[model samples]
Target: MKRLLILAALLPFTALAAPLNVDNNPNQPGYEIPSQQRMQSRMLNQQQQNKGMLNQQLKVQTQQQQQHLQNQMNNNQQRIQQTQPGMLNTPSTKPVAPRNGDMLKQY
Candidate 1:
């Protein structure tokens, strides 16, 4: 029949006019707004900058500790040289004077 053919042609268009289900779709929200993407990118950049600063500070602290240890070693070496320069094995610097007990013994 002619009426049945016309009705069938108009039937497919009705489905296209229906409202889309926005809640069930995943790709709809991100494409609609760009501010959320920008915020996430800024947070990632800030974390990387903080990590770089921490590494630089750690290197400076290590250098300072090494320099302090070297200075201490040099100071200790200088002290040892000043305290005992020549007499390492001798116990005391006592005098040897001739007495009556030494005169009876043969030289």
Candidate 2:
């Protein structure tokens, strides 16, 4: 049990000490650091491309929503015009002036 505990403690250190290979090309040396750098750069470019596509989609959706709102506003304006074309020339809310003096006059 003591040996097992010691092996477990040393296992992570052994893994860290081992060389990791990032190169997919079998013709090149496994220790070539440039391949890892290239891989990282490729990943970054893919992320940038994804972001660009998302931005384009967002722009298209925003434009579509804006056009829909504009159409609704135009329809509402047309309805108002058709329903009451002379709304601007509306008469006062007061009743017509009483004719022939007030009926309440004791005359």
TM-score for each candidate, following the candidate numbering: 0.50, 0.49
Backbone clashes under 3 angstroms, per model: 0, 0
Residues 1-107, candidate 1, lDDT per residue (tens digit)? Answer: 89999999998887665545454355766553457778988999999999999999999999999999999999998878876866464577779898878878668
Query: How much is 53 displaced in model 2, in angstroms?
Result: 0.6
Q: In terms of TM-score, how similar is model 1 to the real structure?
A: 0.50
* lDDT (10s digit) by residue, model 2, range 28-53: 76545677889999999999999999
What's every prediction's RMSD, in angstroms? 10.2, 13.9
Query: Which clashing pairs does model 2 show?
Result: none
Q: Whole-model lDDT, candidate 1?
A: 0.81
Error of 1 at 96 (Å): 16
Name the regions of candidate 1 deviating beyond 4 angstroms. Answer: 1-33, 87-107
What is residue 35's positional error in candidate 2, in angstroms?
Answer: 2.4
Model 2 is weakest, by summed lDDT over 10 consecutive residues, at: 17-26
Positional deviation of 78 in candidate 2, in angstroms? 0.6
Q: What is the lDDT of residue 2 in candidate 1?
A: 90
User: Measured by C-alpha RMSD in angstroms, how accurate is candidate 2?
Assistant: 13.9
Model 2 vs. true fold: TM: 0.49
